[model samples]
Target: MGTLIFNLNMMKMMKYRLLFLYILGMTVAACNNDLPDELFVKRVVIAENGFQDLRLEYPEDGTVNTQITISISGTSVLSKDVEAQVKVCPDTLDDYNYERFVQDTMLYYTLLPEDCYTLENEGKVTIKKGDEYALLSVQFDLSRLDMFKDYVLPLEVSSVSDYEVGEPKYRKALFHLNILNNFSYVYTPSGAKVYNSGDNDDYTAWTTDLTLSTLNYNTCRMYAGGVYETDTDRDKYVIQVTVNSDSTLSYTAMTPEINLMAEGDASQNRISISESPDLLVQNKSVITTTLKMNYSYTYTSPEGYPYHRRFEGTFTNDRTVFRDKDGNIREEW
Candidate 1:
């Protein structure tokens, strides 16, 4: 009798399982096509809502022009014109950051200051009759931004004249602008090889990818020999370099700890950057920039041992520049 009751329970559960699957299939089919038009009707939205990562190369005029697109989403275009207003809604920043970071305010994103960017279209966008999209122009001033700080340009389609604005999630844009300088990049795109000598010893050699952080338009800072990025005494070995217009570079130790320094030839450490002719490799033409450095410096190690170190190698990078006729150019190489 128990065996028979168990079989009955199994059959009953199977019937309910099949019924649930049938209902789920019907709901999915309705969502796929049979749903009412009102549910999927067109709504005005900032096309680039969520986030956008922008790399700002050194602009020709110190200003980079960017655009935001606003559109009406639906199966067809609206018959009438629609106007949308965009705003730098920094007030909404706190809530956005809170959602992403919870209570960790230290890691929260920061708003890009007003002086750093100019909204050329004054937050106005118009999709004319028979059109579905419009653009708003914006320009970023490189000089006004801080290199070390993370900035997010928070924007929203605050109001719409015709169609209803998009859902809360689709109405805003968080643009993360990454600014670049002449000699530094967020990526480790350059290689370094260092040859050292200490305590009257022969030579110790090592190689690494050079991570240079920009300090100015033409200068950057890097760790000594491109090593020990997190070393407590790293400041003593940190070097500030200035890439000159003549393709030459000058270096200065951040701390007096690197007491003695000189160029490879025992002169004031000034080196030149070399570039190769555009070459076709893997079906792409690229210009390679090489920084050939030769220098010796004296600094104490973490164990309190003083040593003289020499580095002689080439740090290389290559980038293809894309420019327009309107004085817009990016030569990161």
Candidate 2:
């Protein structure tokens, strides 16, 4: 009887010890789960400044090949090798889809086919061991896209092997591309001479300097005889120029009245300029235009003299080529 009791006691003690160990192990595991993960993306660095919107201006060199560099960094020096999958997918969000995504919390994005640009890397990126960051090279072809439309290229880190992805916004890099077709430019005018028919040779019609500042992507304000100066004494004239869909350049005078004199009686005598059919030209870099000017004047005299004069001539202007301080050509327009 003594041996049986001793054996039963030993078995019960052993079961209790095993149960205590199991509970302790579970508690330890739960405590460990509370700790944060150490591996994460530290920051994403872009090579160019103001790259968040990524507005690509039309290249003056006329080449479509342009590239931007991006780097992915980790919080600490990586101990083990890590791999990430990246893709350049089109932003398929239409007006309705975007609205729904904003309104509904459970919605996810669905990617559509990419039609506008070409990527050089086939959209794969990797970071090896001992490397703090990974570098990505992306080249965009602007010539393949329509200059008038808006496009987007979303560079996404789809998955990571050893480390957790960074912030939700940083995980996917969104590049909004807007192609600006503004053809406005500053030009030097030559071979421009004024012709007067109504005894008012004081009013010169030729433009020695001209500037076309863009009002929008397609239209511009063509100014002659100074920028933003509208006083009649300065002889300033403003015209509206537009770049049509067919790449043709056209212009119409915005201000029709050109006061010859501000204080004298000749102020009553003004030159009225009009261009018909919207002067069309093919080349933007250098252009020669012939416009007809009608000069109508009513002098404050005893005879009540009224004179109508017509002047016509050709004027040539060349776009001022932009250059860096080193004298290298930066742009044409």
Candidate 3:
């Protein structure tokens, strides 16, 4: 009896294992069926008016013919009834005046209302479950500008199932162009200068150092780097000036010469002007001054380096002069 019972138990275990395998196989087949076959877009057709190639001219004043064709192929979805709807919404753009939030939505496409582009002639087509390929077509009208213009068009595709699929998506078609502009420039640029002296001789006679006042043109400021002074004493002052964009500048200076001799060492012939004179004459005296400047500018589009300009002017006032008290005039000054 024990041997018979053990054999019976072994047979029962084998039967149960076979039953589990059969059920598992059926489950897998069911899951596979639940997934839809893959659908593909094989070709896209763009109508003549659809895209404006600025490089290629269509009928500038009239219209042009345009169309789009799409091809598709896949295995799993062939057996199922598949229908698609094409929606083209020239994405709405915002042209606002608000400061904080400025949005640019360039929607430049013209399509029929109801916002749907149906494939003409062939509305619904059927494919066998094992079928490998299919095709879809979309058509539209495009208007041409009399002169020239810029525009953008967006195309979208999706499955039409009164039932929900996943989400809708689209691709963008870009177009750009330029028309005529009629505005005019009312103002023009001219050269202007600032100076301390009028003649070259006085320019050399004046002190080497010269201060530059803030310069302005049409409310714009200028910058500089190099030292600027009379050409005569160019070594004494190293003035660097850089003018800002859209501006021009000029400068001038005046300097005076001095006669001095050494008192202690007669042979030395110390010819120089006193650092600080006791008397500064207002009229009928000698005084010198110098001027220097730099310029910088820019353009609407990318341009080469700025145009650099340099100039000098010097002059002296014979009426107003500086002198020491002693009759011995200041020499080498």
Q: Largest lDDT belongs to which candidate?
A: 1
Winner on lDDT (1 vs 3): 1
* Candidate 2 per-residue C-alpha lDDT over 57-132 given as tens digits, one digit per residue, 9 for 90 to 100: 5554433445555445655565676666666534523333466567663353333236545555665556666675
Better of 1 and 3 by TM-score: 1
Instruction: Write one digit per residue (lDDT tens) for candidate 3, span 1-333.
Output: 999999999999999999999999999999988865544432222222233432212232322323333223333334444454444445521111122244432233333333222344433333233443234343322232222123333443334432222222222232223111110011111122322133323322223333332111111111211233333434322222222232222212211111111112222111111123335442223322211222221111125333222222221111123445653334312
* Model 3 local distance difference test score: 0.30
Worst 10 residues of 1 by lDDT: 266-275
TM-scores, all models, native as reference: 0.69, 0.38, 0.25
lDDT of each: 0.71, 0.48, 0.30
Residue 88 lDDT in candidate 1: 90
In model 1, how large is the Cα lDDT of residue 200? Answer: 31
Badly placed stretches (over 4 Å) of model 2 are 1-51, 60-74, 89-115, 180-333
Please write out the lDDT profile of model 1 over residues 115-200, one tens digit for every residue. Answer: 88888668888988878798888888876766657788989988988768899789987888866676674223233444456443
Number of clashes in every candidate structure?
0, 0, 72
